[model samples]
Target: MSDVGDRNGGNDLVRFEGVTKRFDVAKPALDAITGAVRGGEITGLVGPDGAGKTTLIRLMTGLMLPESGTVQVLGFDTRKDPAAIQAGIGYMPQRFGLYEDLSVQENLDLYADLRGLPRHERAATFDELLAFTDLKRFTSRLAGKLSGGMKQKLGLACALLKKPKLLLLDEPGVGVDPISRRDLWKMVENLTEEGIGVVWSTAYLEEAEACDRVFLLSEGKLLFSGEPKDLTARAAGRVFRVSGIPGRRRQMLTKLLDEDGVVDGVIQGDAIRLVTVKDRETRFSAAGDAEVTAAEPRFEDAFIDMLGGGPGGRSRLAETQRSFTVEGEKPVIEARALTKRFGDFTAADNITFDIPRGQIFGLLGPNGAGKSTTFKMLCGLLKPTNGEGRIAGFDLRRDTAEARNRLGYMAQKFSLYGDLSVSQNLQFFAGVYGLHGAHKRERVDLMTSIFDFRSRQSMSAKVLPLGLKQRLALACAVMHEPEVLFLDEPTSGVDPITRREFWTHINGLVEKGVTVLVTTHFMDEAEYCDRISLIYRGRSIALGSPDELKARVANAENPDPTMEDAFIALIQASEEERMAA
Candidate 1:
């Protein structure tokens, strides 16, 4: 490992001077931004989906040029010497282009060929990357067959094939689990120590907090540029923890968020973590029999505040939602020994769970862990090879149409027609869900108003901003207002404020007695669920409330455990048990 700075003859790898980029939109993708990335340091590009993080990275890679100012990478101007800039940097996009049909080794070799590595250097480079990514054992495995985490590691290895001076990773942790995210961070940190400058763009604030320096952008403008602590200090005294009745945390959170002085509130463990408006002393009376205590602020708290705080009022979408009524006292959703197999491979193994009405039940698992398979079976999208999946007491296998009619599903990826307008998409989904005539038009209008899509209703769904797209997808899912709602990674890459707004709507729906079944990679969002089932290797490994799950991993060394900690611990324990058995 040689010092990248020494080879480049400079510490500053990338520098922007009043850079501006536009893409025929109302706003510039990046507007007059100025920042610098130094060797041996991690520079974090933090922002919401349309916040220009990706645009900035593209400028560094010379894939796109700035409209006005200049972007210099490794002493070469992006506009003048893009080839030199590109040759001096390693870049990985959000969706790393890995050939699904190729094996892990084949993908690595392909990237090596593309990078033009010498024949003598090929063996050493491949060996180092395989060991670094811990992909040696999976060398012969098809890239498509690897888990989400493994795929990310393989992508990183490909990005490093040329061993450039600067590395730019754009949202590398998007779908990766906590353990794998940690591993990716470790890999990046190791590169920094070797004097390779790194730019990490992510919506996850926790990762931003760990960066040596961060440039927080919003709507193509730089909100702040400094150490993460400088930003965290902005929300210092305004943060509080409100603990109330054990089972009433969600209700209390809803009320607390509506308070005049409160800026944001979220469920954290058994309490509601709140951020109040700065300089306001408005007292809160919503937490009955609860204690209010000052709490430490984190990067997310500051990030939300900087973005004008979260949507603090009740969800308008929930207000117009019709209350769903169940006929009998049976569970709203039931999965009894549900199993799905493809030939000899079992994707889901006898998964079982029950959800009563008005509950948010979370189905959590790492990628390729069979949770998705089980969810599809329950949604009537897949036929179960064994056992039953029932909704409102109707068997999914026997009464597929009836079971599907009772549920509204939002897939992980935006499934709406991109070419259609917002209004068209709404009408289409409403029709698909059995809405007709006046009711369909009324529901479409209501969703437009509720989601604040009045001015953008005629805009193409593909061209809308990421947050708006998310809102449209959500509105379409609930247009018919089914008894059960399914959200799969609904807020995957959106910013913190958008996520808060989305959850506010979900909480409102649950309050109206709508049953929700959600699957997410975000551990914090798992706190919103009344109960959770963690699956690993196609088996249910743990089931409990957030606090109960955290308790399973608590010990003297770590008295308090976060949901992520519990998730990683439970999965490790399960793997160890299997090995021993």
Candidate 2:
């Protein structure tokens, strides 16, 4: 990383004083927010969807001005000196604009030209950036063809071409796997050594925990601002791990979450991690035969607590769901020898799995690792070269329509009609799912009530917040109440509370005999699965429950292995074996 210039005498690189930004909505995107970013340190803009993180980041870049207060970037007020702020900062928006058809080198050259790098200096700068991002070997490759991780690296490279004093990254880690996220963090941390101030806006609390300071936002309000450790300290002595329940962690967690003193709970490996109300740690001892022990607090625990705790109790949607049943004890969803090839390049190689009724099966892998291929094949969106995908005993290829009708699919991205209102989208989906007249009206009403979409029912689907959009997509998918559900990264960029709410609904559905097949980048979500198939380079690498998978990678050096640890280790072992072969 190149040193931009001499560090500012003062540590504060950016300052927000009573910053308030509003759009057409009733509530301001950022309401009277006050914060500061210091040089040589990372400041995290942490929040749920529509929490004003993006709006705050945009203000820092001078792309937008606040309505009430001033945003000063590098000692220049954004309103007065937007051009100067733009010139002296590197801003990577959520979707970095990279010309898809252009080669990697060409894109870099374009960004260099746009940033006004002199012709003589372009070569050295390009070389340095390519080496730093490890994209030198793929310079000739088209930007569109690069993997998700590589594309992010290229975007970062483009932003760094001018080596501005401040770097603004808005959810850059979205959709990227854990390995790629780690690499991106390492790259940014190295740049901070040269005194570049970074404002990282993210939904992942783990990323927030690594930041030197964090400003937590919720519903356009600043909830907290300080070092991550200080926030985590708030949840100390409140977190606990309840174990000794085999094959019943989720059940216990659901119950505990609804208990009087329990604030939040989740299934963690073979145990249920709980965070109790402050000063209510000694409420109870045993949960049936289970043992409760105090566990270390994490940033997520603190984050959820600050967000008024998770949306507890059973899912309203699940409660309204009718029971589903299949005869003969056959697997509800099956993938037999699934394989897909594009011009001799295997996207999925002989993958196979069977999900019993009511089971939550997870498909996990790094970006471009073929989990999507497997998912699409099962959904009947893509044709497999050789294999049979069965949904509720209906063959995907042979009985395509029958198979599709029995399943509901929530895609990775929000696939709802952007121009349509929430009610209109739900009605359309109900019709498509074969409901009619009174039945359609009933289902739509149920969805609106269950997902709490009545207030914003007339709002365009595109205008809703990320969390609401996700809820709408899910509502549309499950409105018909299919026997099987396929969720493709349903909680990719949402906050921890939103994720918990999603899982609560999903778990409730499972309890009512709804089989689920899901793909996710978040390791915590993977732990909720009854079993996971870890895919890499178009092949299944590890197949087991969350606990079983963690045990596989556990040792004295790291006796307690997280799902991410197990995932990375298994992938590394597979790569080494392939290289040896």
Candidate 3:
């Protein structure tokens, strides 16, 4: 509500005058949007899926023309002075525009040259950018070979090569680990110190707090714009956290969240954080429950409150501890002392874990933690150099087909043909998985409806947005409805609303007795699984409920460590143990 203006006393670096961008059928992405970007500050755009955050970034960067209004970057008209803006500003899309075939250094060099940095200055620019993004050590590695976090760093490096006055970042923190995100935020802070205005867009509400100012968007309209602390302070002392017995915790939270007084409740590992407008926090406490400590409202809580309550709010939180329960059967999948090596490097070493029937299991880890290799072995795509395994009661090494037939996997990149329509891709996968004719059609139809894929059937897989692409991939992966579904980071780079929608479909599948083994870098998504197995450096270091794993690695020094902190501490301890040994 309060306009802080530029702190550095410079002219407004970027100003949008009733900016409006439109498509043929859908509503205008930015509906008469007018905003100012001040120099020497970081402004964040926060919103749900399809809320025009990316569209706003594209318009500012001159990637698209506003249908009616005008967008100005660095005082230059977006439509008239497009070349000037393109020359002076850096932009990173939700998808990093890196060339997969090129090495990281080469990608940076390509962007440097494209931005017209001279030969002599190019070297210094490349070195400085690499240092800023902390990717100097991996400069020569192929961009495709790098992990998700590394790729994100590389993308930022490429964008920063020329020292643009205005920087536009679109969802830069999505899928990155918390430490990396924190580092990235620090880098943004430094850039603002140098008088470079940054307009950042992200789906994670917590990230919006670091910006000097935040603009909340919903359905292409600005809902609120102010300092995040001020906005959240409006509901301060209205939220509290409760931790106690699991059953009782869920019961109290559900009743409070559903009752008339409570505004919202978020399940944050071993605690149910509730928000109410009533101001009195003690009214909801029951016997045997831990004290409800007054807490600040998280970005997620504010966003959820803004949206009211979506479906499955309580049920989703309750399923946080969903464990695999198989009647009269051993585990359907097992990996014992698994060791995988590539040349002299070991991807997986002495790793062991088990998957039971009809369970939603998770692989939680940082980048390069051997999750991909372990996933490969479980799906029978790769053979282990040492150790033994089984899938669906079939020997993984011997009965590869028997194991493969029972398992369906969705790779990290979503191995669908992008050129084909959604329906065509589904048909192809249905046939590949042995479904034919009427049965194949029925399965495809069911998947389309299940994932809300009806409207985008005719659109090419490549043309569909990030959320639609996920739905299409999920549809293809489950065409045959295999007993076990292995999804590798299925929700990476997706928005919060779409991520919730994606998980809703996943929850439904879990209800149908389908076993799911998913790997994700997202700590929040890790909380949604029935049970999680945290893998680090090729070993299952901790496996249990999200709260249980966090408790196992619980630092008494930081008693309220989040799932992200627990994961980092766990890996740090393991790394220390390995070094000492």
- TM-score of each predicted structure versus truth: 0.96, 0.96, 0.86
Over 1-581, each residue of candidate 2 has an lDDT whose tens digit, in order, gives 12222232367888888988889578888889887888889999898788888888888888888899888788788889899888889988888589989999999989988999999999999999999999999999999998888999999999999998899999989888999999999999998998899999898888999999999999899999999999999999999888888555666677777788888888886778888889864554337767878899999998999888888857888888888755458898899999999997999999989999988999999999999999999999999999889998888889999999999999998899999999999999999999998989999999999889988989999989889999999999998988899999999888888899999999888888899999999999998999999999999999999999999999999999999899999999999999999
Candidate 1 lDDT = 0.89
| Per-residue lDDT value at 553 in model 3 | 70
Could you give the C-alpha RMSD of every candidate to the true structure, in order shown?
2.1, 2.1, 4.5
Candidate 2 segments exceeding 4 Å error: 1-9, 24-26, 281-286, 325-328
lDDT score of residue 207 within candidate 2: 92
Best by lDDT: 2
lDDT of 3: 0.76
C-alpha RMSD in Å of predicted model 2 compared with the true structure: 2.1
Runs of candidate 1 with Cα error greater than 4 angstroms are 1-10, 325-328
- Please give the CA lDDT of all the candidate structures: 0.89, 0.89, 0.76
Better of 1 and 3 by TM-score: 1
Tens-place lDDT digits, model 1, residues 223-287: 89999999999999999988755555778888888888898889986788999889999588887
Q: What tens-digit string does per-residue lDDT give for candidate 3 at 245-302?
A: 4452434545565556576664555566776754544477442456667786766666
Instruction: List pairs with backbone clashes in candidate 1.
Output: none
